[model samples]
Target: MPLPEFNLYPDFNTVRLSHAYLNVSDLAASKAFYCDTLGLQITDESETHVYLRAMEERGHHCLVLQKSDAPGTVDAVGFKTYDEADLDRAEAWFQAQGRPTQWVIRPYQGRTLLTSDNLGIPLEFYHKMDRLPSIHQKYALYNGVKPLRIDHFNCFSPDVDASVAFYNSMGFRVTEYTEDEDSKRLWAAWMHRKGGVHDMAFTNGTGPRLHHVAFWVPTPLNIIDLLDLMATTGYVDNIERGPGRHGISNAFFLYVLDPDGHRIEIYCSDYQTVDPDLEPIKWDLTDPQRQTLWGAPAPKSWFEHGTRFTDAETRDSDIAASPIIAP
Candidate 1:
């Protein structure tokens, strides 16, 4: 069968990737990593879930982590289209593909569609959402550097090429890639959707899993503030790597993990690629600089450990691919 094409039906006019949900084993540790280390504010919370947002965004939440007893995984990811028309079109397109999706009504968020992806990750699409009424008054004091909102997520899959193909068919662009000695394998690729590179990305790994959730800060200085905040909060040990630049997006970055070992990345000043004619870049796996232009190698856990998510068994056939291979 041909790959499923991403069709933003008439109603699903413009879909933008949004928040990521995580299942954490320890609520306090998870909360400290995000709030104290990463500087994301806890907008609201209940017994099961915690809603968080960047200081600059008024959205009800940008990252929602929940407390769970079982082994953790990505619970869901939120995507928003331009308007109601786009939402309708999105629903139509998914339905046409015979994918199982459901319409959901949320409190701060409006009409949303729940679906599964080829990688077995739970996904969501929305058109309208309700913002917190107090954000305007409360967040006004956020004079410190602030990021806009959550931008993209990167996942590890057994098959990098297949994962890239799946997302590309869904309208994601491969802005950058790294390939190995064997022509049959790809190591990593940065993808983009709705504008910025990487609504989500696929890295060759041992299993299907989430690598990190990235947020776009307004300026590089905000990144400094983030570092300072992390240091001041005594969350410095949570720093995975960076406060360094990357060769791919040219964006400066810093990565930190929440309580359950789920990674969250803070980033800013990535190159923009709204133009249609841009070419995708490929990197040699042998490149000495692939890991970092300057810095120690990523920890073994960084390459090996990542969170996974479950899908609705939306694919007609399963393809075997390795996300991360032993280096």
Candidate 2:
């Protein structure tokens, strides 16, 4: 089925993916993985939580780790809007659809609206965050991959078509997608509010789990350097996949597991998508190159494992649903 017309929900103008909230069992261990090893800078921290950002980020944080006894899980995926009114528009639109919504006062952030997507993935919308000095030129402070900024998030949804439609209504444009070869059913989509390929993507999978949150490294060699650092630091087992190119986005990428088992990707070399008339690139699900340009198959774990998200208000695990498999 074709995607619903764009702007189905009027005045919903999301700017970009801003941050991802994760529940981790050990804050210290996660800090070591994300900060010391991955090169993210610690912006703020408390006994129960830590806020981190990449070198190029002006915002206070792009990733938040909250202390929890449960296994590592995603708490929410956050997006920034053009202004505070855009967040109000989103809240009203979601309420009109009968989705539960709440206003939250988060530290270092302006007024926030928390809601769940159709698939029950926790979503947050906000307009303001505390700004910090960019550390891109601070070469002496760089370490590991020396990631520049948080790039994108890949999430799992049982219904890819519905997820695409939901985000499309929120002004996200599809830059690339995959569909079943025979049935032509939507399997996955890369959507964006920013100029690059995708600020967020949805893949065909179980429930509202998080596949990975990506950080933009300066170059492909940065990915290699991180691998070397990981190996030297006895974190070789954390390497999950690639320093390979993806035919879909044409990005050089590497995926690794943090100490809490949450996945993060170090990515580089993707083109911008600023043309309004740009047609979305489509791929057949059976095409190996759709996922990897170098013909490397993704591991079974990559397909089956992802961090579950918790409900924003109730703090309960979102129920997993069966995926719509292509015939």
Candidate 3:
């Protein structure tokens, strides 16, 4: 099947992927992982919550950790629109599709719209956020891999093809995708708006689980430093996979689990995909190197495990295929 046409004139303009809300078992532990180890600056914090922003991000926050008894549940992944008018347009767009939405009061954000996609992945869309001075040049404040910005989010989609088609309608273009050879179906896709590989990616797996939230780091050296830090610290066991390249995006990566088992990827070096006409790069499901161009095979947990979406109902997916896995 051919890729869907890019929606040039959608009802609203979504600028790029924004923040993610997650529930953590312990605020102190999660803080150590994100702010101390991962190099995200704590923008604000309270007794029950902490907001974090990357070094280069001017937004109030890119990730929010909420202390909860039921840890490992993701509240929502988010995106930003062009302006307040676009937020209004977005509300109409979702309402047109009969998707329920709510205007919620969020700290440091203006008029947040809480909604979901056709697959029921919880999403938050907003246009306004408080800004902060850049701390990119603050050498002394740097810690762990020194992540520069939020890169993308990958989700476990029960139906990859459907996920691609749906996001395609919202103006997210396909940069690359993995195909199921026997079925000739899309097994995974890297869809983007901000253009460095992907702002979002979907992998066929169980329904509505977040595969990993990725952050762009300075270089491959950062991954090496992070590995050393994890080994010396108490988090050597948190390394899930990588310190390798992905054939699909050509990005070097390292995946680690947070205290709550929420997956985080330190990534860099993916090529651009800004041109709307750019054809999608395709990989067969059977390609071993597609996942790791050079490294040990990914553990089974990398494929089968992910952060569950809060209050989202799960269902079995109809499409099925067997792909390569680590022994």
Candidate 4:
């Protein structure tokens, strides 16, 4: 079948990265890491899941930690669209792809779509979600400061080419790519949909898995503030990497591990690609410049920390059976 018209997928004017789902082995530990160290506030909780929001938003939650029998698994990434029309259009787009989706409307979330990506991660889309006004607006104690929302999620897939094809088929345009011509393998590529990336990303991996969930802060200083807080909260060891700039988006970044080992990145200053005709970037995997414009390869940990999705969800039969390389 011909690909559906992508512009018809709700034509979202802007998309705010909403939440990340973690299947945590220890609920309390995960809760403490987010609230105590990261400074997120609890918005809701039940026996099975805990929902949190940045101090700025009264949204029901920005991150959901679901109690899973297995730790270190990423359940899904959530994105917020503008309205019901966007949700309806997105659902139509998925339905045309012959993919299975579960639609849900909860007490906290309005109409939402829980669908599987080619990488096996469950992806959620919603509109008409509500959030409280920033606390900074209410008190001088927080004057002129508020936490920005989530930025994007990096996902893993055994076959990068297949993952790329799946996302492109659904209108996710590539913003950057890393390839190895001699090996004839596509290692990774950054794709964007709605606007900024908040969906599937394919990394060179054995199968579907999650790499990290990223949140955006308004300024670079917030990253430093977070680092200081990490030290103060006794989560100093959780600092996985720097206060550095990424070549891909030219955004400053810091990566840390949650209590459950799921990765969270704080970043700022990525450029916008809302132009009608933005081209994809091609970076050679072997090119040192791909990882850093002026540095060494991403440590092995950066490559290994991302999680993989199950075969049934990715909708790609080949990936479901592939064996992952162990670090």
Q: What is the TM-score of each candidate against the true structure?
A: 0.82, 0.93, 0.98, 0.81
Model 4 misplacement above 4 A: 1-16, 55-58, 85-89, 136-147, 183-185, 197-200, 308-327
Please report the TM-score between candidate 3 and the true structure.
0.98
Q: Report the C-alpha lDDT of model 1 over 1-327, residue by residue, as the tens digit.
A: 122233323324445677877888878877767775565778888878888887667678888888887546787788877777766776776777566688876657888888766666777888766676555346554543355678888877666777777566566767778866555466788877667777787766655677888988777777788778777766678677777776667787888766677787878777777765677777666564565556345566777677777432222212333222224
- Minimum summed lDDT over a 10-residue window in model 1 is located at 312-321
What C-alpha root-mean-square deviation, in Å, does candidate 4 show against the real structure? Answer: 4.8
Query: Candidate 4 — what's its lDDT?
Result: 0.67
- Determine the backbone clash count of candidate 3: 0
Q: Could you give candidate 2's per-residue lDDT for residues 124-207 as a string of tens digits?
A: 999999988878898998997998999999987777887898788778888998876555568789988889999989877676
Overall lDDT per candidate, in order of appearance? 0.70, 0.85, 0.89, 0.67
TM-score of 4: 0.81
Q: After superposing candidate 1, which stretches have Cα over 4 Å from the reference? A: 1-14, 95-98, 133-145, 219-225, 228-233, 310-327
Model 2 vs. true fold: TM: 0.93
Number of clashing pairs per prediction, in order = 25, 0, 0, 12
* lDDT value for model 2: 0.85
